[model samples]
Target: MNAIIHILQTQSNGILEALGQHISISLISLFIAAIIAIPLAIILMTHKRIAEIILQITSILQTIPSLALLGILIPFVGIGTIPSIIALVVYAVMPIFQNTYSGLTTIDPNLEEAAEAFGLSRTKKLIKFQLPLAMPMIISGIRIAMVMIIGTATLAALIGAGGLGTYILLGIETNNNALLLIGAILSAILTLIFSALINGISKLSLKKIGILFSVVVVLFGGFAGYRSFVKPTVNVTIAGKMGSEPQILINMYKELIEQDHPNMKVSLKPNFGGTSFLYKALESGSVDIYPEFTGTVLESLVKTNKNVSHNPEKTYQVAKDLLKKQANMEYLKPMQYQNGYDLAVKRSFAKKYNLKTISDLVRVEHRLHAGFDPDFYQQSDGYPGIKKAYGLDLASVKTMEPSIRYKAIANGKVNIVDGYTTDPEIQEYDLVALKDDKNHFPPYQGAPLMTEKFAMKHPEIKTTLNKLSGKITTADMQKMNYLVTVKHEKASKVAHDYLVSKKLLK
Candidate 1:
């Protein structure tokens, strides 16, 4: 009950904004689907062979996974509203097209003959006689399309498109069930409302329906004009990885930036495909800022295998300097703690093997089965490099989801798993993090990375964001992650509370 009130009271603005984007995207897709499908359906009535081919094509599109379709579209069209709408239109077309074809072909032959007896022109016959009778089936098709599109539209958030799905995804990432529930409930409500509107219009008299359609056209035109011409005063977009820590950090930036610069518009685009995705988005101008780690910038972006200085402060400076020279990117002050990747095993397993460090794991590694996230195998500082550095050979390695890795180790599904130092599950599952005795993995102090040009242009924005520097301690991050994943608190509220406690905001 408290969760419900929190969402309603605290997150109301986000809910409305997402709702508008969701409705606008779905409606535009449905409108486009109707325009294309209805005309094609009419043409196909006279050409059955062509109808079969086109129907097969659209049927295949419906079979493509929503996320996969969006991914494929991204490379060609890039991300955001355009690719999302294109994907939604592809998904929506078949239902409306199939229904239109069926409605026209299945029209009563006696009524058609009666219309022909009046010497009706072909165009007039379609508009005056055939279309009116087919309206019900077409409307039914549209209702199905609209509902389906609403659910699928949520996937658009994965590609950085704004919609209600953003809330749901963030909720899941941050372990905020209330935010998740609100996003879901609003999506369902929106779906039902759209379905009801279509049904109501279908039931209206022809003249009344025509009047309503005209009004819709005018309203849509005005909205398009507003979106194109009337821009916000300041737009700052912040993106980050898909986890509670990054979500909290980005939300903090959002709160602080908006509070400090009230006239500036701040947007959160968290849970990107990966760090690489965020990098590309930043480079291409889709985003202005994002939370990153010093070590990740050095290792992944710079592709450096050599370790930097041992001191955290010096290491941060090294990373910052490297970023400035190599990519013209700026690294702001880092958080107080390091969230470096670590290898962990269950407490019992560790005791039995007497494993206190990565080198210790090498002693009994050949007898152990290892589990790691896919990124571990792909990254330079991940499993393969770690194994090479430590000269260890495990019996087997399996790729697993990050969230399930802790349970896998605890349940003995895998004897060892890769983890982060700040992961809350480590304490919960009673696992032990193996020390990096060989110092193979570099330090990963979290910070915000942006283009130097952007920083120079918006100096105050940098100052507002840097308020988070050295603020979140290691224990603080673990506690926040635990609160979201274990306690089910909202990420936004968690961030807000933390800022208030720090007096970063009032």
Candidate 2:
């Protein structure tokens, strides 16, 4: 309880910002769904054959996984609030459509006959009688959609559309319980508030619905207008992976860029999936920049795996050349840290086995089980490559989520796990990262990746961002990660303090 209160107090501004985003997107999505579903429902009621087909289509859409829907939309619409809104609207259509059709068709046959006998026009009857009678059912559909959207909108954070989900995603990535709880509770509270409002309005007369809806439109329109008029002159968007290090780097870049150029508005896009989403977004012009590792660029993105060395400078050079030649993206200078994946074990396990390096583990390979993330397990440099390279294999292995890999090893669920050298858990759990004596992994030096077109348009951005190069050392990154992952500190605050200490920002 104290932790929750402290989070609310210290993160009041962020909570409010996320709150506004959450409400705005939810309302907009509900409004859009109503427009699409209500009219389609009315039109389809007359065409029974067509209605069945359309309803089936909408039902199928509702069944599609939310994350999968977002991924499908990202390449077409790119990231941010637009794609998020589109996905939410798709998910929200069914309830509204079904209820609207039910409400209109469920009217008594005698009422239609009486209206025709009284010579009332079709449009007039629909407006003066049918619609008013059906209003309750229509409102109920909207209520259902509003509630669902409130929850679904939380996933928007995965694609960089800010909401309370931002805290939740970041919380899970950094392992911060307080941040996770805050996001979850606030989202529930927002849903309840909107549900109550809809219920109250549903009980009122049709005239009251119109009046309340108009008020909502006016308020939202005014806020939109205010934002448009005050938009910044130069807009720079920075995207990154879901982990703590990427968050730190992107936040650091945002702070530096905004501090150096007050006229520019810098946005941080968080990608919860992986680097592929961001890479495509950058190429497709959805995002302008992101922090990438040299080895990942060369090996994973560039597919230049053979004979890669442990030298950071060589890795950076190779990655820069390949990226520039193939994708027209520029690679900035590398940071003073190597975050390559290494096999790690609890210090006690290493001591008991007398293991100090990758080669040393071969002796105990048959007796030990290993845990690794599925991504690492499947990658070329992962377990498969490791087994072939060293001619050794573990007795058993399990693929698990990256977030739990460290905990799994620490708790004796596995004897070894794949981990980044800079992971804070290494220090927290008193784990020893075995030496890579044969240079099996490429040098994973941190660097900034930006599209050449964006760089040329805003040449100053590259210069400003490159200021981060050679600044964040191994210890610096580990400590910053520890603050967020262990101490529950916000990434922006951690980045800001690091910049102040480096004399890079005021």
- CA shift of 205, model 2, Å: 2.3
Clashing pairs in 2: none
Q: Which residue pairs clash in candidate 1? A: none
Off by over 4 Å in 2: 106-120, 259-263, 270-273, 305-307, 345-378, 387-401, 404-416, 434-438, 500-506
RMSD to native for every prediction?
A: 4.3, 3.2
Q: How accurate is candidate 1 locally (lDDT)?
A: 0.84
Q: Which lDDT tens digits does candidate 1 get at residues 1-506?
A: 69878778976887888889998898889989988998999988879889989999999999998866775665567668898999999999999999999888889999889989999988899988688899899898999999999999998887678899988877766556677788899999998888889998998876787788779878987998898888665588888777778888889999999999888898777776566667767776667898888777776786444566567898789888888988899889998989989998889888988889999987897888988877776787788778789988889999865666666787888988998899988888899999999887778899988999999999998998888888888999999888877776767889999899989997
User: 118, model 1: CA deviation in Å?
Assistant: 5.4
How big is the positional error of residue 300 in model 2, measured in Å on the Cα after superposition? 2.6
On TM-score, the leading prediction is: 2
